[model samples]
Target chain A: MTDRSQLPAIRQQVTELVLAGSPEHAEEAINETAEKFGDLAVVEVLGELEPQVASLHLSSFDGGKMSLATLLIPPKAWAESLAYFAATWDEDWIEDEPEVLAESLFAHIHGMVFGTDDEERRAELLNAALATDWGTTAFAVLFSTAAEEIIEIANDIHNLGAHRSGSTTSDHDVIPMALEIARTNEEGWDRILFEIFPDWRPGENELHAASEEESDDDLGDEEARESEFAMGRSTKELLLRLRKQVPSKAVAPAKKGARPSLGEDIFS
Target chain B: MNITSYTARTPQLVQALEALGQRADEQAAGILFDELCGITALVAKKFTNDRTAEGIHEAFHLTVGCISLAISQADIADTGEAKLSFLLQHGAEYVFQMGFRHIKELSALPYTAFVSDFDNDPFVQQRNLKAIFMEICSADPATTWSGDAVYQNEIVDRKRNQHIIDCGKWLRKHNAAGVVRDSEMDANAAITVAVLFALSGDGRIVARTAQRPLENLIAHIRDTKPDVDASWDKFLKKIPPEFQPLLRERMEQLRGTIVKKLYGKTKPKTLLTELQDHYIGSEQDIDYA
Candidate 1:
């Protein structure tokens, strides 16, 4: 665990070095800046970056581990720089969704140009930026937009509670409950999405297999067995029906007995 | 007195009518009269594009106002015939709009569509309403967009009991970060807020004044000087010990040049400039690997 007090010094060094020029010159400026300002911005930004590595905390009892990741964006006045470069570099593509790509590009430049002090953070941020189609803006937009919409919904529901109440109803009771639902649905969506599909897009096959595995892990309870069967039956029915309707190029074998039979497997 | 006659006479009663429609106990005639008046007021606002007290008395019926009238009749036994006739004529056209869909669905319910008071089964109505919103929003991507696309995607992504819990976790992280205050958020509240936020594409949650200084500092990292790992560490320390490593690990894995690209700015005076610079983009070179 790192000490939080060191942040101020690191922040100062990073600030001075950012003002100074070039990676080569940065070392000297950072040192001087650190001595003068003590752990300023430059060092804070550049210091602890580790390459493509993260810590995973494991349960002492189960030895189960979970990966902890990082994303580091360096501070620089590169917004205009990135926008201009993107605009001219790919004029044809710029019109497609400039906001999306600009966000991605700027995010990339920020990380690479300013660089990370933490090696692990540096690697993670850079990697994530490169790996994901959209960059920080997408994330920021998603987060902020979601928050705003939720608040609006909550306010609307609250207003409805107050505005729509009858002789028997009290405003206090209805508003808070409606507000709570609006809030829950808003926040739960992202967490659920990320948890289920960390990759952003988990295909149906992968999704099914994951669910099956999850079900299998639980030794057969009657309810679990029945639910799994029901799910499997419904999924099969959906796939078969879809295949028939779409005239699939590929054939899927219908499962015997337990699975719904689509006569003359279309994919075949 | 016939409710429709009253509604026809008093045009400004739609809001009151809608409010009356919410309650089971309201004298059906009185409620109907008030709702018609509210609908008239609404129509007046629509045609005039603003409200005038006298315009509220204009008895002219818009398509939606008619449907609302019909749907209101769906509730009462005595007025069902005349209202049904009006609805049958225009309900198809009116139903195309979202507000009428809400009216139609609520009218179909055994309980009044709009509830005057909070009930123990508030979740039932809330969920039903939310589902209706989702349907309306998702009807056509071009015509109607989900305010909570990301959230909907999550639900559609997987079928799991744990999804609810997982959503709570995501909401908590987002709620605590930058300009978002602890007072403004809790797990349940965060989840609801996230859903609404996702749908509308508006990010404002808590007031800027309500946020803590450390929260502001974190915002600086995310928007202006993004050191995801560092910020993660800084944030994690402030959070409960159990959550620190979890958040830290997530941030660590999310790092890279792209992550760097997103947030590495050095503004001397304030973090806002750096955030804006990134938001707008800079005239820099692209480094693709």
Candidate 2:
């Protein structure tokens, strides 16, 4: 939707503002430009102007000062920028490792906006991240570091019945995706899940109840129903096995709506 | 290949020296110093102290050389001079400290050579003269020591004595007007005095001349109403341990006077409590030697 010809002028304006000792103005200009242009185009400009922007930011010597253009820009913009970089990463264009760059950007976003009261922005950012393959490694790290934020976003998405177009991703897709990614690093599965569900446990009755609840809802078609059933069965099996595998001492205290305790002493 | 192996690692040493000289700030200097420390540790482990002395001497020489160069090229209007001076002073101190820590008997040749080089360099001498004049001129009038009476009879440099007189006159004029400016220049002036005193042959005599200034500075600080964020603690920390007793004694005397000034007639217990609240005593030791 953005006019391609305006980018160079915007960049020049930003540079002039920074040079004129109006960093706040420069930040405003950058954010405005990012909003006007799509994320990919703005990110390309940012990548080219990274050194100049970094120098300008570092000259002031206040870490908390949001002078970094990336920080001032929207979360969705950064997510999309990251996605673009991941898609088009080449060794000749970018000397630094793409994964490292993506991780650092994601970490910065997570630090600034993850647990804040910006639920809509957080969901959009998470969705943008999930939309890219470059985010898999970053997500694994994020899953551990920001389990609550990720889980909260997943729950919100589920409640709203939001799914990516042309994909069968449902409200419960996040758990399976997380499990698949987490299995690559098997050592973190117990800790990650414990932090995610906290007091979750698997029992036959609970599994049955979850299946019945799914069935009662509109599943759309026979194929959809069969697929949902298969996914639910696998998820329940994974959770049950994971619940069993987790050391009893590591289990969190039960929350109000958490499942009741089973009689078996897993720790023993 | 045999000849190459036999050759001294002078290029590597030069490269390291250049890298060190290029450090423009305290943080950079600290990083370079840490690297030097690591290199020195490794060298010490691998070779004899005699062999390691070459590298150590080269480092010291390069540090002094860089400082001399910076001094020669300093522009006071810009902050470059202040940054360079900070790097030089702290960098030199770090080098000496590390050398003393690692090498038991650090050869004095490199230090002597640096001093000789610094003294003979006309640019450096001129800079030092200008610095001494500036330090004296900007010094707190109330705390400015009148060295004319003490050094008049002694056979000292005429220019130095004249500068001292000029400083005394300026201090009298400013102190009468109650004009005081707190700046980094003040910290630099103090450092200049300390460095000059250390480099002088008759350091004890210099210390004696500074006694009045030290006392006046302490009294002036005490007379000022204390605040929670007062820089008095930081000033105390800056003074070397050898000079601390003199300042401490002066501070205690000033405290008594201030207490009397505050309360015309107070009990000993009340005075003690008031003093305790006003002045926080510190236990940390400062070593500048």
Candidate 3:
């Protein structure tokens, strides 16, 4: 086996290759390192990428096999450029030839959200993304993701709100599991959704709002744009189910219920 | 709302196409996801205006995620490469069109009556729930589908097994692939016939047209569960030195593509699949001649 100590130097070497705008070389280096150290070693090294220098990894990402590396790199630091973050997460971009596609960029953002086991780091990343652009703000993008996922997961667990026959029980099946899964993501979700994401209609940031950039002929009424943020009805139902079945801070209240009381007659 | 925008020019995809141009079939598989993305967008623009660069990108990711799950659970490879052929039969655009279609169905819930009054038909409920479930899964950072072991082993697995079987069988000539017990010949006769078939150029297993039959035989090997993995290492002792390379190369190829743990302790599994009748377009049939 190669000397274990040299791995740090190799990681540094790979970082330099990435900075030089030669992603292909970096990929080859990683693949070689993987053969010697196994995938986990390289994944650890890549995850330790200098957040600023490694930003070039995504910028220069092309058709090389470094798709995995581009995926793992942290977002460009806040001090480095909000414009860069805006470009990656912007809701209204129309590139003639997009160097980065929405799917890949979102995958990177998802990676950034969970990159550290540290809950505080995830919150910091989420907060920065939310603050960067009002157009399809980070909250909207992540909520849309959570909304779609909740509906899908509900199908497996809810069984159409009917109890299963014989040995099956909802206790064994969905709720406890949902609560546990909700807990697994203590870093992101629940608190992040409820606390940081107060506005569904964060309104258009200068970058992603199209009307300001486009001519008047392309204009539509404010009503059409506002309608997009109403949230999908089925998604709303699933979140409701989640809040009811497994209450947590990650869950958002679609509409606040009547004020609570110790007893039904207490308020009366 | 789905992110919707369009760009006719995608330089990264263009680069993927050019890179694929100089690569081998083995190498091409690695870049297939990227290659499919570009091809899907180009093909999709003809059919719908709702697509955004982001929508198409995410749609393909979901579709491939479903495909990967099917592949992982299927008795596809030491089981057999039958499923990969199953993949190859469809034009890339067709697979992607299914994905874009899924995106539309997500909010519409067209198949399920939005009214939650349970349908009297249990199968209808199963169909609708699975359809909804496919719309999300463990791959998403957003969902908790992977949290429960019972949900996976007891509930989700039945869905998994059926999906790959459907994919594995859907494209084959209806009877060409199946359980080994159904094979018409006994082992000795099958061996003789296989040799004779190889002697005849039209029936050679290595030819382009024999893709289905070859996959079928591999499926049979998996089902039959011959203790080949135990014997595979020792068998090399009997082979003449000159031809050993050929046998090793062939085994390696199968290991890389279809069959798994070839010389290991376990019996392999087989996979199959079906296409929705609606996915078929009238004019798109290939000319067999």
Candidate 4:
């Protein structure tokens, strides 16, 4: 892991560039600079104090809007790019190198947007993603965290003809492809949600609960039936039937504070 | 895990025994069972002292009560044929600790239609019914909380007193006609309107308590002025006896205040102040005495 002390440099560079400048002016600089970097093909910057980590497009080119984001962080937390896939998905990531995969994704998005791989800014982006206050700021922090691979793809597509050895993917096409992959991964999570939250799931049981009047009536009827059968059938059968009927999965809830008394014959 | 194991065993035996008996209605029986299961879950959360046995027991009992109430409401001879308006009103009264006035308002066509057809309209339909009720209450202060805490409590106390007076009046009115048909609506409406009157803090208490004397006065007025409207006379007579005198005195004081302001002894609170002032004396002299 990189030492934590290095984060200040990354934060300072971002504050100086993006924060110090107006959003409109910074946006213009970003668009002009991203094209310049893509044309040059070699990502290099000259400076002792002001290191150019990446070029970002802050305006429209080819009808797509450009926005700029920067990141500064310690090298220790810089090894891997982590993407938060919250709304249920499958574990489709097949690669063994998690950190390398993350880094690659980060480099891809940054390269696509800026046309240069700026490590200082990349590091800062990673730090922001891992920070607790991520939600309060612009949504780009989240996009940046996920942008690693997508950025690389965009950059490769933008500079497609430069490397003659292999063909490059186009920038416009890369985003839709990445979105398709993301959606594919999200299907499993959707299934899990349906399995958990019945109200969100489709069915008569879910619909009945949504109603104001009949829900109480339905609940009443269900309870009476369960109690009537509680003595005549096995508890396992009763529970199984209930679980099958209702969408909510049943786990024997944890008994709190003290053990329950089994002697009372309230049902009898 | 131990408790789960124990519960798993006992409820099974209990279930087995329960299944052997014949139920009043198997469909209703199933619904009741489901409700009990829900209540059991609720009880488990609440009375956790004996989490295992007590939770299950409490839930089972509550479930039984819930099912019984549901069945009773449903089994009554009149079901769907009962007017939706009355059902909605009664349902609100039973479920919500709402005052009668609110019950009337929510059940009114405009509000009920807005809630039920909210989705097609989008602007108002998506809102929850209870939230809409609270919003309506918040907009009208007198319809909700009384102006002050003391007044609210007094209103509640006077309301009960007013109900007693109403029942007495109804009985007297019924006796005069030699009719003895029970009227739930009349009794309910009396208490409900009295609640509003008390809440208004209009010192309608004396008038409300003076129902008997007022009724007698109205009966006399109708007998003498056979051509006069009986219902209008009844309404006027229902106004408390003390309120008439208090209102007259207030009108006189208002006239004096207005005259003083008109003469420039006191500046009017507004430009057209005389128009706003009470001409109650003239109105009352012609009507009441």
Report the lDDT tens digits of candidate 4 across residue range A1-268.
2343433443344335544554455444434444544312111111111212222111111123333322221222221111111111112331233333333333434433234266444434333332422111111222323333433432343344223212324343334423322233333222222222223322222211112243356667866544332112211222222223222235556333212322222211
**CAPRI classification of candidate 3:** incorrect
List fnat, each candidate.
0.00, 0.00, 0.00, 0.00
Residues A1-268 of candidate 1: C-alpha lDDT, one tens digit per residue: 2455665555455344434433334345445544554553433534342211001000010112111111222322121122122222243344345345434433444334233356454444433432332222222222222333333333344346434422333333223322322233333333323322243332222211223254556466734544433222122222222122221234534222222222221101
Best by TM-score: 3
Q: What lDDT does each candidate get?
A: 0.33, 0.37, 0.38, 0.31
- Candidate 4 lDDT over residue span B90-111, tens digit each: 3312211223223223322232
lDDT of 2 by residue, B179-202 (tens): 323211221122222322222222
DockQ of each model vs. true complex: 0.00, 0.00, 0.01, 0.01
Better of 3 and 4 by TM-score: 3
Off by over 4 Å in 2: A1-6, A12-23, A31-268, B1-289
Candidate 1 wrong stretches, greater than 4 Å: A1-104, A107-115, A130-268, B1-66, B69-289
The candidate 1 chain A region of ten consecutive residues with least summed lDDT is A52-61
